[model samples]
Target: MTTPRIVVIGAGLGGTIAAYEINGAVGNRAEILMISDSDTYSFVPSNPWVAVRWREPEAIQVHLPPIFAKKRIGFTSAGAKRIHPAEKRVDLNNGESVNYDYLVIATGPDLAFDEIEGFGPNGGHTVSVCHTSHASEAADAFEEFCKNPGPIVVGAAQGASCYGPAYEFALILDTELKRRKIRDKVPMTFVTAEPYIGHLGLDGVGDTKTLLESELRNRHIKWITNARVTSFEAGMAHVEEVADDGSVKSKHDLPFGYSMLLPAFRGVPAVRDIEGLTNPRGFILVDKHQRNPKFPEIFALGVCVAIPPTGPTPVPVGVPKTGFMIESMVTAIAENFVEILDGKEPTHEATWNAVCLADFGDGGVAFVAQPQIPPRNLNWSASGKWVHLAKIGFEKYFLRKVRKGESEPFYEKLALHVMGIRKLKM
Candidate 1:
């Protein structure tokens, strides 16, 4: 009998770790292959620091080809052009196709910058930290902005699922400017689609509403919530403040010498627009076991998986797929694969808990939300200088794991156990 093939698409944080954990679980029972656009893996959470020149790009990157070879996993960087789920094949950009017995879609998000005019780093007025390359370019722009600092604007756009980085970059910029003594000249404005400062798409974890709002006020940063960015000019941003009734309350043209706005995300083209496979937004639809209902052999995790909003808001907001939550999904999928190989039903479920550390250059905010949504068992948030330190430690530890080809190391599992944090549901 031919060995079953397992293909994992994308090699970001979730995909890379998923490959490792799944390999550990299934052992030699199945052939494992990873398809990624690049052979380098970047620590995405540290992109904000890269933008401020706090860390070099190479420092946080891992060369994946060596790691995969050492782990005895097949790898390619040809990238996927399309996924033919019905045929169990993925067409590559390099004019090749790979057939799989089971596939894991972890393509992450496709930044929807084209939806808004003059947005994003690509041929756009503003910059981005969504990618390590973008962050490097942003660092150059920051140096230029400092030469003649003026008004600065930062926030997340409508349908932006990840808000922690926006908040982190905004404060990191603040911290950097203060250190340079240019903060006095750089008037800052934070604009977001969220109804309030700390909604964070999960409806304000713990007292985040108060914690984030107070931080902004203390930093002398002005804010505009329920904001929809209409467009961007060379030196200005057109924004509309919406009322609770979904009407425009006010309009403003905020001038900026430098701006960074997080764009909305959708499923990548490779797996999008397929009936019964994805939602209208192109995010893969998965069951409780992280398996597609129409295609049980297909499992998905990370930002590519479709998740509903916690509730409704004046503007569109998406629930964030944080690090802890993605880890849980990875664990559940790996366990389910083991069950399937054993001729048993796949029954594992991820906890989907959220644990985030939003670092400013000097201080930061931390939050924990069990179940990651509303009306949870535990919802807590805090802030201090220790968070900044913890974030640095996390970045180093995670990069080390990638370099060493280790997932869920003993120390990590022990720490989570002590903190009562778990990846799988009981």
Candidate 2:
């Protein structure tokens, strides 16, 4: 019998994790082909540090060739332009094609700065941290601002999918300016579509609502929640601020010499128009098992999955899958895919389980909640020198393992259980 071909699109966190897991746990069971536009993986979680000059752009960027050689996996430095689910083939930007028995579309989100006029390729005015390039540009601008000293406004814009960066940028920049003794000369403001602090699009995790509010106050960062920025100019942000009584305030302008706003994410152009293949917003629709419902051969995890908000932004919000949860979902999906090919039914499901390490100005805080939703338990959070040291340690460990094609199941399991992605069966 011929070994099945497994094609993974977009070598980001989800796709890479899938490749490592399949190679480690089910190598002989399938032939894995990983496709990506670039040859290296950018460490996204550290982009905030790069924006504030804590990490160098080249430091977190890694090439894929070494890992492919050592791990014995096929790496394709090509972009996936389309998915012919019916034909079991993928289209490439270079007009080449690859056929596959199984397809995992983990290409992640395409930052839609275009949607927010004056951003992205369309020459949108605001700066962003969506990718390594964007982060680099923003960092350079940040340095210029520090040297020149100007009013700064940093926040996530309307429809942004990743909200953590906004919070981190605000805190990190605040710290950076203070270190230079120029913080008193700059006024920083946070603008967002989230209804309240810690809303983070997924709602709130643990005591996230109270936790974030308290932290922001302690750091002296002013915030405008429920704000929908209409547009940005060279030195001003025109925003429609939402009031506590659900009233709309018109055309309020916030001025700044430097700013960083997160953009909304849309699906890659290739996966568009595959009916029921994506949500209205263009994210792949997946079951708790992480398998595409429309096409069994397709699957998605991480920021690529389209999940409805549990409620509005102000409540305890929802869960985030930055560090731990993405790995867990990848593991379960890889194992489940192998089972189906082996004629074994799969019974694994991982919800939005997560343990997010958020960095603050002086230090950071780690939060974990089972199921990532309500009924919080076992509060295990701390801040200080150790937290910062551990954050750096984890990054090195993660990068090393990923480069070596090693899948750490212990972290995966802990992520699932701690975030309550898995509820213990009675």
Candidate 3:
């Protein structure tokens, strides 16, 4: 009897974590093949550091082959074109086909700059941190701006889920400009789709609103909240005031010499057309176990999940799937995959899950949500240099674990338990 082959699309956090866990068999009857469009996975969380020249993409990215080879995992670096889920075959960009017994569709979000005028695909008039190349360009743009100081604006546009980056870029730029001794010359403004500072989709996780607002005031960084950016012309950002009901009732314009507004995200093109496999917005809809709702043999995790709002905030709101939240999904997918293959039942309860990470730039801030977004218990957050150091520690640990094919059962269990707690169930 031949070993069953598992084909996983996308090599992002969720996809990579799944491959890491499933590469070794549950009981030695399966082989895992991880396919990705890129040879190396980018640490999207620190992409702002790349934008500000604190980190370089090449310094951060590691090749996918050696790690896969270590785990006896097969690897393919090609674009996934289509999936025949029922037939267990996936079409590749090279016109090749691979068959599998099980499939995990972890194709992460496609940064849709096109959603906002003057950004994405053709490249934004301003730089971005959404991709390594974008970050590199942002660094170059920063250098040019430093050589000739001018006004700067940074934030997220309408419909952006990852609002943390907006805050990160703003504070980081403040630090960078001050270091270059041009902070006073440049008029800095923090523009965001968030109804207010620190309302990072999780609804002001752990005094985030207070910390962020206080920091902005201390740094003398100006901010405009509840504003939806309309477009970017030569040197000005067109924006508008949004109604509490989340509608564009009024409009205005602002100017900038340097700006980095995170664009909206949508489902990747390859997974978009798969019938009944995705939500209307193209996000993969998953159950608590991270299994695709429409296809049991398929699973998804990370920014790919379609999570509706738990409540409303000041600006247009979307749920955030930060680092730890994604890791929880990875763990759930891994354990459940084992259960499904072993003919045993698996249960993953997602209730009170929180993301605990330090947001870097001006020192850093840490957030812990008892429950996700809002309606929490013990939502304590703080900022300091130690938080920044801890972030580095985490990056090192994550890279080592993935490279070594090791999963800490303790960490995984802690995440699940936290989620269970947040859900308010025993």
Each model's TM-score, in the order given?
Answer: 0.97, 0.91, 0.91
Count clashing pairs, candidate 1: 0
The positional error of residue 378 in candidate 1, measured at the CA in angstroms, is 0.4
lDDT tens per residue, model 1, 79-131: 99999999999999999999999999999999999999999898999999999
**Candidate 2 residue lDDT tens string, 1-426:** 888888888888777877888777776778888989999898887888887778888888878877877887888887888888889999888899999988888888877777665554236666777787788888887888877887777777777767777887788888888899998898878887788888776556656678777877887778888887777777888878776565675557888888788777777888876787887777888887888887887878877777766565421122344656677788778778768977987667764455666776577666664556554453334345444555676667667777677777535544334334455321
Query: Which ten residues in a row are the worst by lDDT in model 2?
Result: 312-321
Measured on C-alpha atoms, candidate 3 has an lDDT of 0.75
Poorest 10 consecutive residues of model 3 by lDDT?
Answer: 410-419
> 1 or 3, which is superior by lDDT?
1
Weakest ten-residue segment in model 1 by summed lDDT: 410-419
Clashing pairs in 3: 195-315, 202-373, 351-423, 352-419, 352-422, 352-423
Ranking by lDDT: 1, 3, 2
The alpha-carbon deviation from the true structure for residue 49 of candidate 3, after best TM-score superposition, in angstroms, is 1.3
